[model samples]
Every structure is written in C-alpha cells, then in structure tokens.
Target: MGAGPVYGQEVVLTAEVDLAEIVRSKYDFDVAGHYSRPGIFQLTVDESPRSVVARKA
Candidate 1:
C-alpha cells in the first residue's frame, strides 16, 4: 500500500427552524455521499445551533 496527500477545503450552511414547537424534535436531513475522481478526503457536514458547516476534506 501507498500513502496519499491531503487537501483542505471549507464550506458553510444555514437553515431556519420553528422555535414554537415541542422542546425537542427529531429532524432528518437528506444527505448523500459523493462519487468523483480521487483527490483528497471526503465530504462532511458540521451542524450547530444556528447554522451548519460543510466541507470536503
């Protein structure tokens, strides 16, 4: 086996939610994997209270 190099990338996302609903609710996100030419790492999502962060690492 051989080692590989790594590339860096940054992404940002946002969404709105209804704060008048139940204290807590389960919400689903329709996210899928990516298929493309090899380069570095893979795509990922970083979720937060006010926004979401995505990146291709």
Candidate 2:
C-alpha cells in the first residue's frame, strides 16, 4: 500500500497485486508452468476530502 497527499485534491492510495502470486496462492498453480502475460493493477480513490486529509501543524 502507498499513500500521498494531492495538494488541492484528495489523498491517493495505491495498491498493487501480482497475478502470478494470486494464482499460486488460490489454486496452487504456477503461471510459469503455462504461458501467461504479465499484469499490473492501479486503483484510485476520489471521495470526501476531509476523510482523506490530515490536520496540518
């Protein structure tokens, strides 16, 4: 997980997951054994500003 403040916008939180790890954990499968393409995920959060901000000192 990663976070950063966006000046005038809401804070951003980023989470990344590896598809190969998911398959290996869920079904005991190895992506390396089969032909698979690499994958990456990026998600964004845009909601209440108050909830995302931290009080300034």
* lDDT per residue as tens, model 2, 8-55: 767656878777986678666455544353354334587755755678
Total clashing pairs for each candidate: 0, 0
Tell me which residue pairs clash in candidate 2: none
**Runs in model 2 with CA error above 4 Å?**
1-10, 27-57
lDDT tens digits by residue: candidate 1, 1-57: 223343474434444666754344323322332234335446777675663677779
What TM-score would every model get versus the actual structure?
A: 0.20, 0.26
Give the top-scoring candidate (TM-score). 2
- Which stretches in model 1 have alpha-carbon errors above 4 Å? 1-8, 23-57
User: Candidate 1: what lDDT?
Assistant: 0.46
Give the clash total for candidate 1. 0
